[model samples]
Target: MTTPAHVAIIMDGNGRWAKARGLPRLAGHRAGVEALRQSVKTASRLGIEWLTVYAFSSENWSRPPSEVSDLLGLLKLFIRRDLAELHRSGVRVRVIGERDDLQPDIRLLLEEAESLTAGNGALNLVIAFNYGGRDEIVRAMRKIAADVEAGRTSSASITPQTVSEALDTNGIPDPDLVIRTSGEMRLSNFLLWQAAYSELIFLPCLWPDFTPEQFEEALRQFSVRERRFGGRNERDVVSSSA
Candidate 1:
Protein backbone atom coordinates (compact mmCIF):
# COMPACT_ATOMS: atom_id res chain seq x y z
CA MET A 1 0.00 0.00 0.00
CA THR A 2 1.07 3.59 -0.58
CA THR A 3 1.56 5.18 2.78
CA PRO A 4 1.15 8.92 3.08
CA ALA A 5 4.16 11.00 4.01
CA HIS A 6 2.08 13.15 6.32
CA VAL A 7 -1.27 12.38 7.93
CA ALA A 8 -3.44 14.82 9.86
CA ILE A 9 -6.32 13.77 12.09
CA ILE A 10 -9.25 15.70 13.48
CA MET A 11 -9.89 13.99 16.80
CA ASP A 12 -13.60 14.28 17.53
CA GLY A 13 -16.48 12.75 19.51
CA ASN A 14 -14.84 12.66 22.93
CA GLY A 15 -17.88 14.05 24.72
CA ARG A 16 -20.24 11.75 22.87
CA TRP A 17 -18.02 8.79 23.54
CA ALA A 18 -18.12 9.55 27.26
CA LYS A 19 -21.89 10.07 27.25
CA ALA A 20 -22.37 6.78 25.48
CA ARG A 21 -20.56 5.01 28.30
CA GLY A 22 -22.35 6.93 31.05
CA LEU A 23 -19.04 8.50 32.00
CA PRO A 24 -18.01 12.11 32.38
CA ARG A 25 -16.58 13.90 29.34
CA LEU A 26 -13.23 14.11 31.03
CA ALA A 27 -13.05 10.32 30.95
CA GLY A 28 -13.47 10.39 27.21
CA HIS A 29 -10.77 13.05 26.81
CA ARG A 30 -8.40 10.93 28.88
CA ALA A 31 -9.05 7.95 26.63
CA GLY A 32 -8.48 10.16 23.60
CA VAL A 33 -5.06 11.03 24.95
CA GLU A 34 -4.21 7.35 25.13
CA ALA A 35 -5.42 6.95 21.58
CA LEU A 36 -3.08 9.76 20.55
CA ARG A 37 -0.14 8.00 22.17
CA GLN A 38 -0.92 4.79 20.34
CA SER A 39 -1.34 6.70 17.07
CA VAL A 40 2.12 8.21 17.42
CA LYS A 41 3.62 4.76 17.85
CA THR A 42 1.66 3.35 14.95
CA ALA A 43 2.59 6.16 12.60
CA SER A 44 6.26 5.91 13.47
CA ARG A 45 6.29 2.14 13.05
CA LEU A 46 4.61 2.45 9.71
CA GLY A 47 7.37 4.84 8.54
CA ILE A 48 5.07 7.80 8.23
CA GLU A 49 7.14 10.97 8.35
CA TRP A 50 4.66 13.35 9.90
CA LEU A 51 1.49 13.22 11.98
CA THR A 52 -0.60 16.21 13.05
CA VAL A 53 -3.45 16.03 15.56
CA TYR A 54 -6.09 18.65 16.21
CA ALA A 55 -6.02 18.75 19.99
CA PHE A 56 -7.74 22.05 20.70
CA SER A 57 -9.29 24.80 18.64
CA SER A 58 -9.60 28.52 19.23
CA GLU A 59 -13.39 28.25 19.25
CA ASN A 60 -13.20 25.56 21.90
CA TRP A 61 -12.82 28.34 24.44
CA SER A 62 -16.53 28.95 24.05
CA ARG A 63 -17.16 25.67 25.82
CA PRO A 64 -17.93 25.68 29.53
CA PRO A 65 -15.04 26.94 31.60
CA SER A 66 -14.83 23.65 33.49
CA GLU A 67 -14.50 21.66 30.31
CA VAL A 68 -11.93 24.05 28.91
CA SER A 69 -9.90 23.77 32.06
CA ASP A 70 -10.10 20.03 31.90
CA LEU A 71 -8.87 20.00 28.34
CA LEU A 72 -5.93 22.28 29.18
CA GLY A 73 -5.07 20.11 32.14
CA LEU A 74 -5.06 17.05 29.95
CA LEU A 75 -2.73 18.80 27.49
CA LYS A 76 -0.31 19.58 30.29
CA LEU A 77 -0.41 16.01 31.54
CA PHE A 78 0.16 14.60 28.08
CA ILE A 79 3.23 16.75 27.53
CA ARG A 80 4.76 16.13 30.95
CA ARG A 81 4.06 12.40 30.97
CA ASP A 82 4.80 11.65 27.32
CA LEU A 83 7.51 14.13 26.32
CA ALA A 84 10.40 11.98 27.42
CA GLU A 85 9.01 8.88 25.73
CA LEU A 86 8.27 10.82 22.57
CA HIS A 87 11.77 12.23 22.42
CA ARG A 88 13.28 8.84 23.21
CA SER A 89 11.30 7.36 20.32
CA GLY A 90 12.71 9.93 17.87
CA VAL A 91 9.54 11.98 17.49
CA ARG A 92 10.16 15.66 16.98
CA VAL A 93 7.30 17.67 18.45
CA ARG A 94 5.99 20.76 16.71
CA VAL A 95 3.14 22.97 17.92
CA ILE A 96 1.29 25.09 15.37
CA GLY A 97 -1.23 27.61 16.66
CA GLU A 98 -1.69 30.98 18.24
CA ARG A 99 0.08 31.21 21.63
CA ASP A 100 0.56 34.90 22.33
CA ASP A 101 -2.10 35.14 25.04
CA LEU A 102 -1.73 31.69 26.57
CA GLN A 103 -0.83 31.38 30.24
CA PRO A 104 2.87 31.60 30.98
CA ASP A 105 3.08 28.04 32.29
CA ILE A 106 1.26 26.49 29.35
CA ARG A 107 3.39 28.44 26.89
CA LEU A 108 6.55 27.29 28.67
CA LEU A 109 5.49 23.65 28.54
CA LEU A 110 4.78 23.88 24.81
CA GLU A 111 8.15 25.47 24.19
CA GLU A 112 9.87 22.85 26.30
CA ALA A 113 8.29 20.02 24.36
CA GLU A 114 9.39 21.48 21.05
CA SER A 115 12.90 22.28 22.23
CA LEU A 116 13.49 18.89 23.82
CA THR A 117 12.42 16.98 20.70
CA ALA A 118 13.97 19.36 18.18
CA GLY A 119 16.68 16.90 17.19
CA ASN A 120 14.57 13.77 16.81
CA GLY A 121 13.96 12.50 13.26
CA ALA A 122 11.72 9.44 13.27
CA LEU A 123 8.43 11.32 13.01
CA ASN A 124 7.16 14.87 13.11
CA LEU A 125 4.30 15.17 15.60
CA VAL A 126 2.40 18.44 15.28
CA ILE A 127 -0.14 19.41 17.92
CA ALA A 128 -2.71 21.95 16.85
CA PHE A 129 -3.70 23.63 20.09
CA ASN A 130 -5.79 26.79 19.99
CA TYR A 131 -5.79 26.51 16.24
CA GLY A 132 -8.28 27.66 13.64
CA GLY A 133 -7.73 27.48 9.89
CA ARG A 134 -9.31 30.83 9.08
CA ASP A 135 -7.50 32.43 11.99
CA GLU A 136 -4.21 31.08 10.70
CA ILE A 137 -4.90 32.53 7.28
CA VAL A 138 -5.79 35.88 8.79
CA ARG A 139 -2.61 35.93 10.83
CA ALA A 140 -0.59 35.15 7.75
CA MET A 141 -2.31 37.94 5.89
CA ARG A 142 -1.56 40.33 8.71
CA LYS A 143 2.10 39.45 8.52
CA ILE A 144 2.13 39.97 4.79
CA ALA A 145 0.35 43.24 5.17
CA ALA A 146 2.81 44.39 7.79
CA ASP A 147 5.71 43.52 5.52
CA VAL A 148 4.16 45.50 2.70
CA GLU A 149 3.56 48.50 4.95
CA ALA A 150 7.13 48.36 6.16
CA GLY A 151 8.36 48.31 2.54
CA ARG A 152 10.00 44.94 3.22
CA THR A 153 8.22 43.42 0.23
CA SER A 154 5.84 44.68 -2.40
CA SER A 155 2.24 43.43 -2.38
CA ALA A 156 2.57 42.47 -6.03
CA SER A 157 5.63 40.36 -5.31
CA ILE A 158 3.82 38.24 -2.74
CA THR A 159 2.79 34.84 -4.09
CA PRO A 160 1.08 31.75 -2.77
CA GLN A 161 4.40 30.48 -1.45
CA THR A 162 4.87 33.72 0.44
CA VAL A 163 1.47 33.37 2.03
CA SER A 164 2.22 29.76 2.93
CA GLU A 165 5.51 30.70 4.56
CA ALA A 166 3.75 33.32 6.64
CA LEU A 167 1.36 30.76 8.08
CA ASP A 168 2.06 28.97 11.38
CA THR A 169 3.12 25.80 9.54
CA ASN A 170 5.86 27.55 7.57
CA GLY A 171 8.44 24.81 7.18
CA ILE A 172 6.14 21.85 7.47
CA PRO A 173 5.00 20.05 4.32
CA ASP A 174 1.29 19.84 3.51
CA PRO A 175 -0.63 16.79 4.69
CA ASP A 176 -1.17 14.07 2.09
CA LEU A 177 -4.10 12.53 3.94
CA VAL A 178 -6.54 13.92 6.50
CA ILE A 179 -8.64 11.66 8.72
CA ARG A 180 -11.55 12.69 10.88
CA THR A 181 -13.04 10.30 13.42
CA SER A 182 -16.65 10.00 14.54
CA GLY A 183 -17.68 10.18 10.89
CA GLU A 184 -17.35 13.94 10.52
CA MET A 185 -17.35 14.99 6.86
CA ARG A 186 -15.96 18.47 7.22
CA LEU A 187 -12.52 19.90 7.76
CA SER A 188 -13.80 21.71 10.86
CA ASN A 189 -11.27 24.53 10.37
CA PHE A 190 -8.28 22.24 10.48
CA LEU A 191 -5.33 22.94 8.18
CA LEU A 192 -7.34 24.85 5.62
CA TRP A 193 -4.48 26.27 3.54
CA GLN A 194 -2.27 23.23 3.87
CA ALA A 195 -4.77 20.46 3.22
CA ALA A 196 -6.16 21.98 0.02
CA TYR A 197 -5.44 18.82 -1.98
CA SER A 198 -5.30 16.23 0.77
CA GLU A 199 -7.37 13.07 0.55
CA LEU A 200 -9.92 12.81 3.34
CA ILE A 201 -11.14 9.77 5.28
CA PHE A 202 -13.93 9.75 7.82
CA LEU A 203 -14.16 6.92 10.33
CA PRO A 204 -17.20 6.17 12.44
CA CYS A 205 -15.13 5.31 15.50
CA LEU A 206 -14.79 7.99 18.13
CA TRP A 207 -11.43 9.58 18.79
CA PRO A 208 -11.04 7.51 21.95
CA ASP A 209 -11.72 4.36 19.99
CA PHE A 210 -9.47 5.00 16.99
CA THR A 211 -7.29 1.97 16.36
CA PRO A 212 -4.33 1.08 14.20
CA GLU A 213 -6.47 -1.21 12.09
CA GLN A 214 -8.84 1.60 11.23
CA PHE A 215 -5.94 3.90 10.40
CA GLU A 216 -4.51 1.22 8.10
CA GLU A 217 -7.88 0.84 6.45
CA ALA A 218 -7.91 4.52 5.69
CA LEU A 219 -4.50 4.14 4.15
CA ARG A 220 -5.74 1.26 2.08
CA GLN A 221 -8.58 3.39 0.79
CA PHE A 222 -6.22 6.21 -0.07
CA SER A 223 -3.88 3.88 -1.94
CA VAL A 224 -6.60 2.76 -4.32
CA ARG A 225 -7.84 6.27 -5.09
CA GLU A 226 -6.23 8.31 -7.83
CA ARG A 227 -5.19 11.85 -7.02
CA ARG A 228 -4.97 14.06 -10.08
CA PHE A 229 -4.97 17.36 -8.21
CA GLY A 230 -7.36 18.97 -10.74
CA GLY A 231 -5.75 17.29 -13.72
CA ARG A 232 -7.07 14.35 -15.69
CA ASN A 233 -5.45 10.94 -16.14
CA GLU A 234 -5.12 9.05 -19.44
CA ARG A 235 -8.12 6.93 -18.42
CA ASP A 236 -10.32 10.03 -18.53
CA VAL A 237 -9.15 10.90 -22.02
CA VAL A 238 -9.81 7.33 -23.27
CA SER A 239 -13.27 7.29 -21.69
CA SER A 240 -14.18 10.66 -23.19
CA SER A 241 -13.18 9.47 -26.70
CA ALA A 242 -15.05 6.13 -26.41
Candidate 2:
Protein backbone atom coordinates (compact mmCIF):
# COMPACT_ATOMS: atom_id res chain seq x y z
CA MET A 1 0.00 0.00 0.00
CA THR A 2 1.14 3.53 -0.69
CA THR A 3 1.34 5.22 2.68
CA PRO A 4 0.62 8.92 2.64
CA ALA A 5 3.68 11.11 3.15
CA HIS A 6 1.74 13.76 5.04
CA VAL A 7 -1.54 13.71 6.96
CA ALA A 8 -3.44 16.62 8.47
CA ILE A 9 -6.31 16.48 10.96
CA ILE A 10 -8.99 18.81 12.17
CA MET A 11 -9.90 17.47 15.60
CA ASP A 12 -13.50 18.40 16.23
CA GLY A 13 -16.39 17.88 18.68
CA ASN A 14 -14.45 18.09 21.92
CA GLY A 15 -17.16 20.14 23.59
CA ARG A 16 -19.78 17.72 22.41
CA TRP A 17 -17.72 14.85 23.68
CA ALA A 18 -17.75 16.40 27.14
CA LYS A 19 -21.44 17.29 26.96
CA ALA A 20 -22.43 13.74 26.10
CA ARG A 21 -20.47 12.44 29.08
CA GLY A 22 -21.64 15.06 31.55
CA LEU A 23 -18.13 16.42 31.96
CA PRO A 24 -16.57 19.85 31.68
CA ARG A 25 -15.26 20.94 28.27
CA LEU A 26 -11.76 20.98 29.68
CA ALA A 27 -12.10 17.27 30.41
CA GLY A 28 -12.82 16.70 26.73
CA HIS A 29 -9.80 18.76 25.73
CA ARG A 30 -7.71 16.68 28.07
CA ALA A 31 -9.03 13.54 26.44
CA GLY A 32 -8.24 15.03 23.06
CA VAL A 33 -4.66 15.45 24.16
CA GLU A 34 -4.57 11.78 25.06
CA ALA A 35 -5.96 10.98 21.64
CA LEU A 36 -3.25 13.12 20.11
CA ARG A 37 -0.62 11.11 21.95
CA GLN A 38 -2.11 7.88 20.66
CA SER A 39 -2.28 9.29 17.15
CA VAL A 40 1.40 10.21 17.22
CA LYS A 41 2.35 6.70 18.24
CA THR A 42 0.10 5.16 15.63
CA ALA A 43 1.30 7.47 12.84
CA SER A 44 4.92 6.81 13.67
CA ARG A 45 4.37 3.06 13.63
CA LEU A 46 2.50 3.38 10.32
CA GLY A 47 5.55 5.09 8.79
CA ILE A 48 3.81 8.36 8.01
CA GLU A 49 6.41 11.10 7.67
CA TRP A 50 4.44 14.24 8.52
CA LEU A 51 1.39 14.91 10.66
CA THR A 52 -0.17 18.33 11.09
CA VAL A 53 -3.07 19.02 13.45
CA TYR A 54 -5.35 21.99 13.84
CA ALA A 55 -5.15 22.59 17.55
CA PHE A 56 -6.41 26.14 17.69
CA SER A 57 -7.62 28.66 15.10
CA SER A 58 -7.14 32.41 15.04
CA GLU A 59 -10.90 32.90 15.33
CA ASN A 60 -10.86 30.92 18.57
CA TRP A 61 -10.05 34.14 20.37
CA SER A 62 -13.77 34.98 20.12
CA ARG A 63 -14.42 32.26 22.65
CA PRO A 64 -14.98 33.11 26.28
CA PRO A 65 -11.83 34.32 28.00
CA SER A 66 -11.94 31.54 30.57
CA GLU A 67 -12.03 28.85 27.92
CA VAL A 68 -9.23 30.48 25.97
CA SER A 69 -7.09 30.66 29.08
CA ASP A 70 -7.75 26.98 29.78
CA LEU A 71 -6.78 26.05 26.24
CA LEU A 72 -3.55 28.01 26.51
CA GLY A 73 -2.76 26.33 29.80
CA LEU A 74 -3.35 22.96 28.23
CA LEU A 75 -1.02 23.84 25.36
CA LYS A 76 1.76 24.80 27.75
CA LEU A 77 1.20 21.66 29.76
CA PHE A 78 1.36 19.47 26.64
CA ILE A 79 4.63 21.08 25.56
CA ARG A 80 6.24 20.71 28.98
CA ARG A 81 5.09 17.15 29.44
CA ASP A 82 5.75 15.76 25.96
CA LEU A 83 8.67 17.68 24.48
CA ALA A 84 11.44 15.56 25.92
CA GLU A 85 9.78 12.23 25.15
CA LEU A 86 8.96 13.37 21.64
CA HIS A 87 12.54 14.39 21.02
CA ARG A 88 13.76 11.04 22.26
CA SER A 89 11.28 9.20 20.06
CA GLY A 90 12.54 11.00 16.94
CA VAL A 91 9.43 13.12 16.59
CA ARG A 92 10.15 16.74 15.69
CA VAL A 93 7.44 19.08 16.97
CA ARG A 94 6.67 22.42 15.32
CA VAL A 95 4.08 25.14 15.93
CA ILE A 96 2.70 27.15 12.95
CA GLY A 97 0.85 30.37 13.62
CA GLU A 98 1.21 33.99 14.61
CA ARG A 99 3.51 34.06 17.63
CA ASP A 100 2.86 37.59 18.80
CA ASP A 101 -0.62 36.69 20.02
CA LEU A 102 0.68 34.07 22.43
CA GLN A 103 1.84 34.71 25.98
CA PRO A 104 5.56 35.37 26.33
CA ASP A 105 6.20 32.19 28.27
CA ILE A 106 4.24 30.06 25.83
CA ARG A 107 6.08 31.60 22.89
CA LEU A 108 9.40 30.84 24.58
CA LEU A 109 8.37 27.27 25.20
CA LEU A 110 7.35 26.85 21.55
CA GLU A 111 10.70 28.13 20.35
CA GLU A 112 12.52 25.91 22.81
CA ALA A 113 10.60 22.84 21.74
CA GLU A 114 11.30 23.53 18.06
CA SER A 115 14.98 24.07 18.73
CA LEU A 116 15.29 20.98 20.87
CA THR A 117 13.72 18.65 18.30
CA ALA A 118 15.24 20.27 15.22
CA GLY A 119 17.61 17.38 14.58
CA ASN A 120 15.06 14.56 14.68
CA GLY A 121 14.03 12.96 11.39
CA ALA A 122 11.39 10.33 12.15
CA LEU A 123 8.10 12.15 12.13
CA ASN A 124 7.46 15.87 11.69
CA LEU A 125 4.47 16.86 13.85
CA VAL A 126 3.07 20.34 13.39
CA ILE A 127 0.46 21.93 15.60
CA ALA A 128 -1.56 24.78 14.21
CA PHE A 129 -2.28 27.01 17.16
CA ASN A 130 -3.78 30.46 16.71
CA TYR A 131 -3.72 29.65 13.01
CA GLY A 132 -6.07 30.45 10.14
CA GLY A 133 -5.79 29.53 6.51
CA ARG A 134 -6.66 33.04 5.33
CA ASP A 135 -4.14 34.52 7.71
CA GLU A 136 -1.43 32.19 6.49
CA ILE A 137 -2.16 33.13 2.88
CA VAL A 138 -2.09 36.82 3.74
CA ARG A 139 1.20 36.40 5.53
CA ALA A 140 2.68 34.61 2.54
CA MET A 141 1.48 37.33 0.23
CA ARG A 142 3.08 40.00 2.38
CA LYS A 143 6.35 38.13 2.36
CA ILE A 144 6.31 37.84 -1.44
CA ALA A 145 5.42 41.51 -1.75
CA ALA A 146 8.35 42.43 0.47
CA ASP A 147 10.68 40.34 -1.65
CA VAL A 148 9.40 42.02 -4.78
CA GLU A 149 9.84 45.48 -3.25
CA ALA A 150 13.44 44.57 -2.30
CA GLY A 151 14.11 43.53 -5.94
CA ARG A 152 14.63 39.93 -4.92
CA THR A 153 11.61 38.74 -6.96
CA SER A 154 9.68 40.35 -9.78
CA SER A 155 5.90 40.42 -10.10
CA ALA A 156 6.17 38.69 -13.49
CA SER A 157 8.15 35.85 -11.90
CA ILE A 158 5.56 35.18 -9.15
CA THR A 159 4.05 31.73 -9.36
CA PRO A 160 2.15 29.21 -7.25
CA GLN A 161 5.41 27.60 -6.18
CA THR A 162 6.79 30.94 -5.12
CA VAL A 163 3.75 31.66 -2.94
CA SER A 164 3.82 28.16 -1.46
CA GLU A 165 7.48 28.52 -0.51
CA ALA A 166 6.67 31.65 1.46
CA LEU A 167 4.10 29.89 3.62
CA ASP A 168 4.78 28.30 7.01
CA THR A 169 4.76 24.82 5.46
CA ASN A 170 7.47 25.65 2.94
CA GLY A 171 9.57 22.55 3.50
CA ILE A 172 6.73 20.16 4.21
CA PRO A 173 4.88 18.19 1.56
CA ASP A 174 1.24 18.92 0.99
CA PRO A 175 -1.03 16.63 2.95
CA ASP A 176 -2.02 13.59 0.95
CA LEU A 177 -4.99 12.98 3.19
CA VAL A 178 -6.93 15.26 5.56
CA ILE A 179 -9.30 13.87 8.18
CA ARG A 180 -11.86 15.79 10.14
CA THR A 181 -13.74 14.07 12.95
CA SER A 182 -17.30 14.50 14.26
CA GLY A 183 -18.69 14.28 10.73
CA GLU A 184 -17.74 17.81 9.80
CA MET A 185 -17.61 18.45 6.05
CA ARG A 186 -16.30 22.00 6.02
CA LEU A 187 -12.60 22.79 5.80
CA SER A 188 -13.01 25.66 8.34
CA ASN A 189 -10.17 27.60 6.71
CA PHE A 190 -7.59 24.96 7.51
CA LEU A 191 -4.64 24.46 5.15
CA LEU A 192 -6.37 26.16 2.26
CA TRP A 193 -3.58 26.08 -0.29
CA GLN A 194 -1.72 23.08 1.07
CA ALA A 195 -4.78 20.84 0.91
CA ALA A 196 -5.86 21.94 -2.54
CA TYR A 197 -6.07 18.37 -3.83
CA SER A 198 -5.99 16.35 -0.63
CA GLU A 199 -8.33 13.44 -0.11
CA LEU A 200 -10.74 14.29 2.71
CA ILE A 201 -12.15 11.84 5.24
CA PHE A 202 -14.95 12.76 7.60
CA LEU A 203 -15.49 10.53 10.60
CA PRO A 204 -18.49 10.48 12.87
CA CYS A 205 -16.43 9.82 16.00
CA LEU A 206 -15.56 12.77 18.18
CA TRP A 207 -11.98 13.81 18.67
CA PRO A 208 -11.58 12.22 22.08
CA ASP A 209 -13.39 9.09 20.97
CA PHE A 210 -11.26 8.64 17.84
CA THR A 211 -9.13 5.51 17.99
CA PRO A 212 -6.23 4.01 16.10
CA GLU A 213 -8.64 1.62 14.39
CA GLN A 214 -10.60 4.55 12.99
CA PHE A 215 -7.43 6.17 11.77
CA GLU A 216 -6.46 2.97 10.01
CA GLU A 217 -9.87 2.73 8.44
CA ALA A 218 -9.46 6.18 6.99
CA LEU A 219 -6.18 5.14 5.45
CA ARG A 220 -7.74 2.05 4.02
CA GLN A 221 -10.40 4.14 2.32
CA PHE A 222 -7.81 6.60 1.13
CA SER A 223 -5.87 3.77 -0.49
CA VAL A 224 -8.84 2.93 -2.71
CA ARG A 225 -9.17 6.40 -4.17
CA GLU A 226 -8.21 7.23 -7.77
CA ARG A 227 -6.01 10.30 -7.38
CA ARG A 228 -5.98 11.66 -10.92
CA PHE A 229 -5.01 15.19 -9.88
CA GLY A 230 -7.27 16.62 -12.63
CA GLY A 231 -5.75 14.36 -15.26
CA ARG A 232 -7.85 12.81 -17.98
CA ASN A 233 -9.13 9.25 -17.61
CA GLU A 234 -6.69 6.57 -18.69
CA ARG A 235 -7.05 2.88 -19.58
CA ASP A 236 -4.05 1.80 -17.51
CA VAL A 237 -6.11 -0.64 -15.44
CA VAL A 238 -7.33 -2.46 -18.52
CA SER A 239 -3.90 -2.41 -20.12
CA SER A 240 -2.29 -3.81 -16.97
CA SER A 241 -4.91 -6.53 -16.68
CA ALA A 242 -4.27 -7.75 -20.22
> Pick by TM-score: which candidate is best?
1
Q: In candidate 2, where is summed lDDT lowest over 10 consecutive residues?
A: 231-240
Deviating ranges (above 4 Å) for candidate 1:
240-242
CA RMSD (A), model 1: 0.9
Question: What would the per-residue lDDT of candidate 2 be over residues 28-89, giving only the tens digit for each residue?
Answer: 99999999999999999999999999999999999999889889889899999998899999
Q: What digit string (tens of lDDT, one per residue) describes model 1 on residues 120-148?
A: 99999999999999999999999999999
Clash pairs detected, candidate 1: none
Lowest summed-lDDT stretch of 10 residues in model 1? Answer: 210-219
Clashing pairs in 2: none
The best candidate by lDDT is: 1
lDDT computed for candidate 1: 0.96
Positional deviation of residue 1's Cα in model 1 after best superposition, in angstroms: 0.6
